[model samples]
Target: MLQETSRDPVGVLVVEDDAVTRKALCLAIESDPGLKLLDAFDSVKPALDFLESSSPDVLMTDLGLPDGSGIDIIHACARRHPATDIMVVTMSSDEANVLACIEAGASGYVLKDAGKLDIARAVLDLRAGGAPMSPAIARMVLAKVRDNKKPAVPQSSPASDTTSLTRREAAILDLIAQGESYGEVAKMLSVSVGTVQTHIKNIYGKLSVHSRGEAVYEAHRRGLLQLGRPPGKRS
Candidate 1:
């Protein structure tokens, strides 16, 4: 159990299309004394509108909303309140949707099958600056990063000239290509996770890649990583 914050209970907003699920989520929020249900909506528009005027401590939503994808909601919350903890509570466990949500700035990913206690715990964990991802979602994320393939060489390529990486940047990319998560890389490098994330952002800019797998492929193409066996596999 977490100590009550000096502030009001953590405000949580829910956006789910299914009436029953939405009601259940509301109940979960209501049951937890540490969390307060700020608002609940069944579509994207109303949710977006409410977000524009108010921001919650946590935003949990299902991806396949009736009006639009929850990625839009994630983007909106991320843009409006950078400190807000955004989570995806959806049925889709595919790599594509998981990656999409991550790219959209979601820090927590929970499957809808999770119990109410689990959902409450996820909300509290997110409030504590933890990334609460289900075990299946965690496996999917790891698989996505570990499944990098060599990108095809283009006819007129400029990314090949990506030799501007600093020594530390290259080192960070190497660790990431080795299937190390940001937290793992941070621990290995004796740096904070935010420091690692900053370096990763710089790496992406230098490599012209958007995600971890793309960064790995680009690093390999640029000879930053030793051409070798599968990533995350120890020799």
Candidate 2:
């Protein structure tokens, strides 16, 4: 894990094919005082070559590239720099590509149309071990989970619920299922973002979910989505 000191910003590596999109992503990440542009590449080979020597705290890549698929870069990061937070910023929302990225250890997925701020925010949230998937991407992932029929825990196992989470954990899981960001959840719960992250880590472990989308799906499968509702049920 890269340590964050007052002297260093969060290092970011961007890999996108489109020149305009690449420039936009670079500017968005660098514009933030919290993030430093480590490097930006338009192809997978160079990015992978660069990763051979260095590992940024965050690796953001698109799905398609001239030389090859961006999933290769994601796989390299997962193997070479396991601590790095990998996010997919691409136009492809196809189920196969999304599932491939997830299996390759991507932490988040944002569409190309998400705007610069959303991209930057997704990178930061991912670095903090919070899955920052866009709403549409989240939905796609949930669809796959349903199609697979692989529940987080077996339906016949009642003890799974009893030993799975504490009330606070359940509450945190609920908020996450509702698509609340870590920062938003922190403010709502009167806790620090780090605390929220810690809870998220625990949530991921208990639920066996790698991304926010999967966590939400698992929560629903386990009948915990209703618990995530806020007071006075607006619906």
Candidate 3:
């Protein structure tokens, strides 16, 4: 029988292609009394299939899978299980990877080099609604923020024509850029998914953009979206 603990265990699904690493992660999660390992998968396909029928409270996934990228897993989970927290547990600490994962609605980012205890602590923090990042990852995020360039405005720029977004609208757009589905944004904002959809439509109309990618790109161009801060942090 699977070892069960008395405390309310946060069910977790582990997704990593490496057999040894996957087993080790599963062991670490099992050792923690606050986490319960619901399932482990070596590829995205099966993991997504399992998520459709069953739900886990947290998802710990690797960035590079043999079949698909971890971003795919994050996108799927955000749609299927909006309330499930996501953590990226991978070897790549590249700034691009970090930004991509966070944009994809991940609540935590931990490198594989993080010790078992660190991973456990990250999971716990994620469950508690805090964005967890390994020390190096956190530093990388800060560096990106520091290096960001301010958008330039022409000297004759008209204030009336300048695109202005409300705090909530900007927050919703940030999440949308980060790859969160409508359902996930709704849960995070405590609003109906229909409300999220309506906001997204209005955002597109204001920006003259048609798709999510376009909206994110436009927001970045306008300096409306910034790195380091989690989506919805402003409101």
* Model 1: per-residue Cα lDDT over 163-229, one tens digit each: 5677677777777655566666667776777787788778766765544544665566566664343
Q: Give the TM-score of candidate 2.
A: 0.66
- Model 2 scores worst on lDDT over the 10 consecutive residues at 226-235
- TM-score, each model? 0.65, 0.66, 0.63
lDDT of 2 at 33: 88
lDDT of each: 0.75, 0.75, 0.75
Who is ahead in TM-score, 1 or 2?
2
lDDT of 3 by residue, 1-235 (tens): 1122126888999999999989988988899988899999999999989988988888999989999899898888866776677888899998888887766667678887766546677787666535677889878765665566565442444432587777788988877655465666778888876677678778767766534544665677677775456655766
Whole-model lDDT, model 3: 0.75
Cα RMSD, model 3: 8.8
Q: Please give the distance, in angstroms, between residue 23's alpha carbon in candidate 3 and its true position after superposition.
A: 1.5
Q: Write the per-residue lDDT of candidate 2 for residues 1-235, one digit (tens) a residue.
A: 1222235678999999899989988999878888999999999899999999998888899988999999999888877876677888889888889878877778688887755446667777776547777788888876765575543454677535553666667777777655566676677777777777787778767766555555665666776555425723422
Which of 2 and 3 is the better model by TM-score?
Answer: 2
